[model samples]
Target: MVTIQLITVKVTAEPSDAVTEGDTVTLTCSVSDVTESMRLVWINSDGKTVVEKTLKEEKQEQGLLQLIIQNADRDRRNWTCVLFHQNIPKVLIPYYLKINMRARILPDIWIITVSSYLFVKLGFAVGLICCLKRMDRISNNRNPPKATGNKETVQLQTLNSDADLRSSNK
Candidate 1:
């Protein structure tokens, strides 16, 4: 006498965590208990069958199924795998396909902030230099240096001594 145990088929998707937007995602469905006859099916969060366009391609191998999602976008919905036994499709495991949006310019938020700060600092420095130069030019233009006549002249230093130091007495 022998007893039979049934109901032990579970399916799981690859990258069982998350996916990034604009990146290709591969959801490979593999069954725990391999059986003689089993079929794989993919369904969306709305329980509707997924279209072929959404799934670029599919591969089947040794009780395993593969699904390719191309151009991953925010519009993508969560998906789950189903296995069919005796032509009756049953629920397997549910996978949450999270399309993570990366930062547009930089991956880290701090890098962008630091770069912005540097650019603003540089701009302020340039503005200050230009302002100072313009002010100096205006001041110089307002005040002109005094000029003497065209005749050549000599500057003589006056002495406080009572005696004259000149060689010829006048």
Candidate 2:
């Protein structure tokens, strides 16, 4: 008769599950049970092994593997923690990372804020111009323009015209 022992492998992210872009992220893999032939490996989304460790190297009863990523990005979002016993894969734990990029959203808000401010200023200038025009119109209606004339100059012109007409008739 033979009995089998179960092992639990877990992966966790340091700082938080979600991080902002350009932040440093750390992924830790821990196993509940450690054996002499047990190996822990960290794999990327592309099925490439990043780091590997064995219980002999750690000299501990529990297995732990850590991978650090500087400047987290979309390319480093997915990872896998694989535990192997005697060169055979036993457990696989996958972790997904969330990165927030504020650069994509802030510009839209800034453009809208600037546009609204300019619109308000333009509206105020237009209203001021309209009010000034209205006031000028009211003032003009109250005081009409007066015509300017020289009385002597008008009389002389009329006399000359009359003389010229009489001479032509004679």
Best by TM-score: 2
- Model 2 regions more than 4 Å off: 1-4, 57-60, 104-170
* lDDT over C-alpha atoms for residue 35 of model 2: 48
Candidate 1 per-residue lDDT, tens place, 1-170, comes to 99763545354444566767777877766554443556677777788767321111233234556777887777664777787766676656787777788657755667888899999999999999999999999998999765465333322332223247543433
lDDT of each: 0.65, 0.86
Task: List clashing residue pairs in candidate 1.
Answer: none
lDDT of 1 at 121: 100
| 10 residues in a row with least lDDT, candidate 2 | 54-63
TM-scores for candidates 1 onward, in order? 0.46, 0.57
- Per-residue C-alpha lDDT of model 2 across residues 134-164, encoded as one tens digit per residue: 9999999999985459788777677678978
